[model samples]
Target: MQEFFAMGGYALYVWSSFGISLLGIVYLYFEARKYHKKQQRLVRYWLHRQSKKKSS
Candidate 1:
């Protein structure tokens, strides 16, 4: 197991790369979720305005 992790002394580079990639994936997920929620809110607001206009 130690040898496997060592990666022939390139362990630091290899491990850090994996950590950075994981963080990027997590960041993208949250960003996408936030964007989706914002879009939904905008859509709902527009629909509400249209309904109000129609009623008036």
Candidate 2:
């Protein structure tokens, strides 16, 4: 197991690369969630306005 993690003495580079890739995926997930929520809010607001206009 230790030898597998060592990666022939390139552990630092290998682990850092893996960490950065994981961070990037997490960041993208949060960003996509934020964008989705914003779009949902916009759609709800538009629908509300249309309903109000129809009632008026």
Which candidate number maximizes TM-score?
2
lDDT at 36 for candidate 2? 100
The models' CA-based lDDT, in order, is 1.00, 0.99
State the TM-score for model 2: 0.93
- Cα lDDT of model 1 by residue, 12-39, tens digit: 9999999999999999999999999999
- Score candidate 1 by TM-score against the native: 0.92
Q: lDDT for model 2, on a 0 to 1 scale?
A: 0.99
lDDT of 2 by residue, 1-56 (tens): 99999999999999999999999999999999999999999999999999999999
Error of 2 at 33 (Å): 0.6
Report each candidate's C-alpha RMSD, comma-separated, in the order given. Answer: 0.7, 0.7
By summed lDDT, the worst window of 10 consecutive residues in model 2 runs over: 2-11
Off by over 4 Å in 2: none
